[model samples]
Target: MAFTESSLLLPSVSGTNKNKNKVPEDKWYLAYIVYFTLGLGYLLPWNAFITAVDYFSFLYPDASVDRIFAVVYMIVGLVGISLIILYSHKSDAYVRINVGLALFVVSLLVVPLLDAFYIKGRVGFYSGFYVTAGAVGLSGVADALVQGSIVGSAGELPDRYMQAVIAGTAASGVLVSALRIFTKAVYPQDASGLQKSANLYFSVSIVIVFLCMVFYNMVHKLPVMKYYKELKVEAVTANEDNGPLTGPVWRSTVWNIVRRIRWYGFGIVLIYVVTLAIFPGYITEDVHSQILKDWYPILLIAGYNVFDLVGKCLTAVYLLQNAKVAIGGCIARLLFFPLFLGCLHGPKFFRTEIPVTILTCLLGLTNGYLTSALMILIPKIVMLQHAETAGIVSVLFLVFGLAAGSVIAWFWVI
Candidate 1:
């Protein structure tokens, strides 16, 4: 799996021996960019929706629609990925990713279109609700396809590529956070301005996802990428000892993978559970300020995203060097729950924006570092043949954590 030596690298299926010598050692950076961009596209829609809580609250008027949307998105992502795993056992990662991204482009467009109509008094709340729910749910399906495929695909490559995809995910959060902050500040503080800005935000997301499809399709053409895919296929197929395990979509195959990597899976779950339980929703629904009441949630979401990106990227420099240390950091994020509560009900100073912002930043930082370390380390811990399955399973754990955390987010209101 450690593809460091020159002798180990080979020409692609159609490539020649001379082409192998021609490939610049650094060309793999292009592949990394492709993986990162896909990762960014996979999560940008969710970030856009989450960061725009004020618009949803204004539209629905009293219903906790944002929380409901977040929970529904997570649940649907889990179900969608499960179906992909159990049913659609296609080896063509490109087709799966493209179809999902195309769906993302179309679904994101539907939101602003419907919002425009609703603003003109031609549509009702239920119309907007159904549209938003359907759009968010559609994005969740795209997330499963893109995320699971990219991670699982990258998992089979060198670990650094997998880290690249995770880095792209963190970058998406940061991108959307910056976009939201700028848009909110520039747009007028009215319903019309909100609608205009929201449409612009989603429009930009559609463009990025579209470019993601274009770039990913191009990435497959790279000789280095083709070599990795072939290498993975040979690894799984060439092993004569793996008789029944050769069946990719079998229940037993999935079970065996889970059984072998239970600790890594559980660590991934705890990482997301602690982070999501209080993010977006807690920062959206709870906490307050007189001066920044309207802008507070948006800015806090930005803070979390910025720190999360910083944390995830930090792994490239100084990973904790131990799996347990990484898991410990994730569990430590649970401390955020009580700390956030203190912000809500403990000391008056704790409830202020400054202290809450500091805690939120720390939460994001720990979450980013621990989750990245565990994901980067997990596949390497398992047999190389099961690396792809391990990546998909890691995604399953992430959705489980998101589902659980979104459910917990509601308890603050209940």
Candidate 2:
């Protein structure tokens, strides 16, 4: 079925002569920037919100309230994300991507408004979790749809786009650190004031998301060639081949890809999940503890983002030069060891900040490379004929990993 789809999508075979020129280099760069900025808007301020929420908890002590909020947020996010995947699979790629970006912008705007106008003083520990999950889920769905559309039109997807997205996430982390510093400087004496300042950052993030959305739409419109049209036609036909869409059409397609891909990548994802789960509190708690006084976590996050961006950008070059999937997989797997060890033993074995910092940097660098490799590997393994199916499969894998990690963290605490 995928073969049939790929044949239809490919210009050589599909015989559809729409736009033959290559995607302009400038447009490609702009697309990356838009993607990166969008990512930053979604993730950066959210990280700050997470930190602020933790700080609020200390200001207004209530364990039961916090737990209740957390559970509810997680449940809603899980359901929302599942729906998003289903929607993306069923809807046109263009609509899904555009709507997803709009949703993200809306969430960014709403959260800040809620913080500034209504919610005050640690409304719940899980408030950030709930809000962020919704924002990110919307963002993810949009991303899947947009990428699928690009693949459908172009017969190929840019491997670097994924890295750009992560890079934006890393950049946002750094920005959060800067904001934390400003918050500390301005509101040294009052925790409530600092929380209000955090709200300001969220508001600013909304503007960023809106701008990126506009930029992406504008760029998408200017006379660009068709690269993925054959891919799209192939996907439509493949769905037809599989029989009428019924219950869990997206899930069925995704699972089939997972079964086809080499188990090694799945293993790597599992290891990453386990490592992240074991150290669930580190990101929000340890980073907060270690850096809050000086806004150190923001610095570490920034460094992580810079390296992550570099790693992602370079992935295409690496694959082109090396062209070895297993080697890339192995490299990504090896990087996890230090992360796992750092989480497990960083506190006990390395009391000082230096060792922990080194460990953290290594984790970011390796993971950046690994993530890039993983993104590239997916299209190759799944076959271009089933690009849409592959995209759905890739996102589902990420969603499951995220969901599992969140659940495991909760379970461990319980």
Candidate 3:
């Protein structure tokens, strides 16, 4: 049987190949924008929960809010990714992504709804805290679903789309930081202000997530998207002739993909481990400025976000084609530990605000560039048919690094 049941469902490879020379236009870069928006959308939930840390911390005074949130979010995300990878052969990326978007909407609504009716700007409501934590976990699962699927999907496309996704994630950070700064500037620094700011975060995130859904649905209709998707189908038909993938065969295929991308995965892991250990936590809690007061951390975060966005965008101009050199760059990020340390316990000049701010921006710059480089490089390393699986495997490693780095943040901070 040349054409199995699965093959029958897919568009005819010969038919698709006919128009291979006539590449469909993206038309105003709509598909690119949609992918970038989806990348931004998936991370907004996590950013919303974390960015509103001030409000959550104010509400739950006894609990260590940031650390707890990190643990809950990362663990749930790790487990969710594991399950997705295990069953990826059975699932469709399109369906998984749509479901994940819906889940994001639900999770974003939880905190604001709880605040409006139950919490009501009150402090010491541990019940609400727990519910909020559950919402964070829900967002984690959503992240695993949407991020893995979309990134995997993008992996099958040209490098620019992946760059858009990476840049969009950085844009999510910048968006949240900008909102945080705006809210802080507008509202008074009090309970009412915290409540308003936090609500604004969730509300804006919700709106963007909706926009993401609309764009995501519309993207498939674009001629360019259809072209690439058909190409993927053609590639799969050519390479995977063994009919429906049985459990053993799928597992072996996954292992093969993993083996090929192990170094890339390790580089991604190391990148995040170093980054998560020092960022936001160190900037927010450890260091203080006599002049800027509470504003110091906020500004530092903004600077980091801005520089990160800059770094991610740089790849659009010039992507380092060498994977080994990029992995080496990831390893080089380890030097950031001591450099950041100098801002704390070293010489007087190093301990000043100027040095600390420079280091933070540098951290973001390196993090953004290296991460974008690695993600764009991963799919190119594997066969087109297995590119999606390879992308998902890379995400698993990224999440593991995130979880480890978050844990390390607890002890690494001075």
Candidate number of the best TM-score: 3
Top candidate, metric lDDT: 3
Off by over 4 Å in 3: 1-18
Higher-scoring candidate on lDDT, 1 or 2: 1
What is the lDDT of every predicted structure here? 0.75, 0.53, 0.88
Candidates 2 and 3, the one with greater TM-score: 3
Q: Higher-TM-score candidate among 1 and 3?
A: 3
Tens-digit per-residue lDDT, 306-371, candidate 1: 898898888777666576676676667777778888899888899888899999999888888888
lDDT of 3 by residue, 3-63 (tens): 1112222334475466576667778888889989998899999999998998999999999
Candidate 3: residue 331 lDDT (0-100): 93
Give the clashing residue pairs of candidate 3, or none: none
lDDT of 2 by residue, 326-394 (tens): 345544555544554555456664545566566666656665666555554555455554555554455
The per-prediction tally of clashing pairs is 0, 15, 0
